[model samples]
Structure formats: structure tokens, C-alpha cells
Target: MPDVRYVTQGTRAAIRRTTREDGAEFVRLARESAAFHRPWLTLPTTERAYLHYIGQLEREDREGFLVCVRETGDIAGFININNIVRGAFQCGSIGYGAFPPAAGQGYMSEGLGLVLRHAFGPLGLHRVEVNIQPGNKVSIGLVKRHGFRLEGFSPDFLYIEGAWRDHERWAMTSDMLDQRTGAG
Candidate 1:
């Protein structure tokens, strides 16, 4: 195993930038988490796809991180900041999922908190958005817990699995994070 450089740490989990070396582990984890993610999102489950994903994350407009268990150094989940628009916009969209062993364990919550701090503090992002299907109560709850507000709904917002899926847009700003954490 290569050295894992954590970008940020929380009590139970840490976030690290995703790397090409993470391909195999991510594929296995995707398989393990398939049932949990089937209705919500899709992950790279093959080596080629994983490599492609790594390439995508390397782009300037995107960033990816793996949420790892702090004690055991195991991958608990992944979060990606995508479609970043710099300059006057300073915004990004995010997608994420938790692996089975970490599911419902609050690791993702800690990881998300760390990621938001990283985004607003170091990355200089002013806003982050998430799109969730209305039926995905767990995901909805996750964003709400982090203080994301429902902005609107989009018909056929994304193409997923075998069809176009409708999504509810949720967003949070740097000011919101600062207010939530009392850091502003």
C-alpha cells in the first residue's frame, strides 16, 4: 500500500484525495455497496472505468476524495466535487456514497463535514450543490443534517442506470457553513 495523505481529519474518518492506486479497492467497494447504491447512484465497478474516473478527477474542474477510517485506514466512502467554476462563480456540485461497512455509521457525516470545511476554507468555493432523487430519504436527510436548502426540482435532471431521473436540487453556501459551525 502507498502512503495515504489525508487532506482533512474528523473524529472517526478522514478525507484523502483519490488516486490512481485506489482503483482496485474502489472497484471492490463498489461491488460491496451495490445494493446500497443501486437506487441512488452509480459507481465505477470495473478497472477501466475506475481508471477513467481517476482521470476525470485529475481535471481542473473536479476534485475527488476518499473517506477513510482513521484508526484502520479503510475506505469508508467517496465524495467528489465536480463542475467547479472558478472566477466569479466559485461553486461546485457534489456526489457521494458510503460503503456497506460504513453505512449508517456516521462516518460519511464526519467525512462530509471535513470536506465542506476543505471546500470553503482552502479550495475557496463559495457554494456546493447536491441533486438527490426525492425518494432517497437517506440522502435527503444527510444534506439536511448538513444544512443544505432545497433550491428547486428538475425534471429528468440526470441520466442514471437505464433512464433519466428527476432530482431535487439542494445547496449550501460558504456563509451557511460558517454560520452552522460558528466560524464566521
Candidate 2:
């Protein structure tokens, strides 16, 4: 089973597995951060869609959570690794977004590093990919900082803002994770 520990980074933030019980809080955060997150996250403008999305996230094995916040309980960010597959393809893709207040504070970076270890080590994933819109410099930097290599450009990889968008493909293998953070 996946361990859902309450993770901490000094007084910076904590990351824990999200549950259906967290629906209201997650919705509240998503609503409040809509303007900031909408460009990257598919924030539902309606309560019904919000509930449906969270429900799926709660039940799917293709998903895992890294719900993060300051020690004071302020919502900082969320990390999601979804669409997991095994067999010859022991890999997954990651997506993340932070509240405006948390941007550039290294919270997302730290949370991502921790989650990568969990994905590649305990989770036995061989590779992880991050797909960022070509113009999302913030996420591009985050992936690069963690030693992800630009593999290629994927056309129409995501639908964001208003239409389908191309993304710069970045990937890291378990070996790269070990070298970057010495987590192995």
C-alpha cells in the first residue's frame, strides 16, 4: 500500500495524501486560486464539476496526491501524478500548481523532489514525465531544476486556457532521480 505520511519541510509546508474527506477544502482552495491556477489547472467554475473531478481523483489508482501547506494550514500547492502504468511502461506523468502566495518560494520544487523519490523508488516507476506548455517558464524551470531532460515537443498535448496547446516534453528516469537528489 502507498504510505500517506504527513510530510514536512521545516516550517515551510507539509504534504499528505488527499482523501474524499478533503473535498471541501480542496474545492475552496481551487476556487480561491482560480485566477492563478486556471491557466495550468482545469479549475471548474461550477460546484458540480468540482465535486466530480475530486471524486475521480479520490478513487483512481492512476492518481496520487501531495497536498501541501504551511504549518499554519494555509494552502500552498498541490502535486498530482496521474495515469500510472506498469508492465514494460513503469512510468507516470506529473502535474502541479501553486497558490499565488506560494509561487517562487521553492515549495513546489521541494514537494516535487519528495514525490519523485516516492514515484521512482518505493513506487518502482522507471520514468517520470512533465508536460508543460511551451510558455510556462515557471514549470519548465522547475522540471529542469530537478534534472529532467527536454525530450521533445508534444503537439496538442494539453487543453488549457481555451484551446489545445503544445507542450515541451521533459523526462527523467530513476537513474537521473538518484543522481540529482541521492535519494536511492
Candidate 3:
């Protein structure tokens, strides 16, 4: 059994397990960022939708979710390492969104690094992928900073903001992770 621990940056921000206690805060951030995220995110039904989303996170397979917090304990973002696959592939994809207030603060970047390490190391995953909207320069830069390579582009890859949009595929393998540490 693997454990999900809190990740932090000095005393500024933290990432930890999502809990029922976070329901209200999560809902607030999700709603507040609806406009900013509507272009890339799937629409939710209601305020309680996060409860259902949290339920999915408890599964032993398929998905995992985390909550990002500011030093003041405000929930600022959400991240997930989902669609996990094992055996021959040993892969998964990352998805995330930050509240309008939290964007550009490097909170997601720090959280991503911590989670990706666990995904490849303790989880024994070989590859992780990120599908970023071509127009989302912030996300593209984040993935690239983490050593993910641009694999290709898929037109109409995701249906977002009412129509299908192109997404650039980026991937990082365990070998690539190792290379970053001179262990490959």
C-alpha cells in the first residue's frame, strides 16, 4: 500500500490528499475558475459534483486526486494522475486546473514534480503523458520544464469550450526521468 503525503514549498504552498472537508473550498475554486477553465475543462453539474469526483478518487485503480493549498489553507488548485494503466504499458496521464487566484504562482509546478516522482518511482509506472491545448502556453511550459517531450499533435483531440480543439501530446518515460538524474 502506497501513501499520499503532503508536498510543500518552504512555507508558501502545500499539496495533500483531497478530503470531504475540502468539498466547499474545492467547489468555490472550481466555480470561480469556470470561465478561465471552460476552454479546457469538462463542465460539472452542480456544487455537489465534487463529492462524486472525490468518490472516484478513492478507487484502488484508475484515478487519484490531490488538493493544492495556500499557506493559509485555502484550496487553490486540483490535480489528478488518472487513467492509470499497468502491465505492458505502465502509463498514466496527468490533468489539473488552478483557481484564477492561484494561477502563475508556480503552485501547480511544484505539485506536479512531487506527484510525477511518486508516479514513476513508488507506483512503478514507466510513462506519463500530458495532453495540453495548443493555445495553453502556461501548461505547455510547465510540462516542458518537467522534462516531458513533445510527442506530436492531434487535431480535434479534445472537445472543449463547445468544439473540438487541437492538443499537443507530451510524454515522459522512466528512462527519461532517470536520465535527468544521470541514472539512465
How does each model score on TM-score?
0.97, 0.86, 0.84
Give the top-scoring candidate (lDDT): 1
Off by over 4 Å in 1: 1-4
> Judged by TM-score relative to the true structure, which candidate is superior, 1 or 3?
1
- Model 3, runs deviating above 4 Å: 1-12, 43-45, 67-70, 182-184
Between the candidate structures 2 and 3, which one is better when assessed by lDDT? 3
Model 3 collision count: 0
Please count the clashing residue pairs in each candidate, in the order shown.
0, 0, 0
List pairs with backbone clashes in candidate 2: none
List, residue by residue over 124-179, the lDDT tens digit for candidate 3: 89999999998888889988898999999999888887899999999999888788
- Cα lDDT computed for each candidate against the true fold: 0.93, 0.74, 0.75
Which model, 1 or 2, shows the larger TM-score? Answer: 1
Kindly list the per-residue Cα lDDT of model 2 for residues 130-168, writing each as its tens digit.
898887888899898999999999898888878898889
Residue 114 lDDT in candidate 3: 68
Could you say which candidate leads in TM-score?
Answer: 1
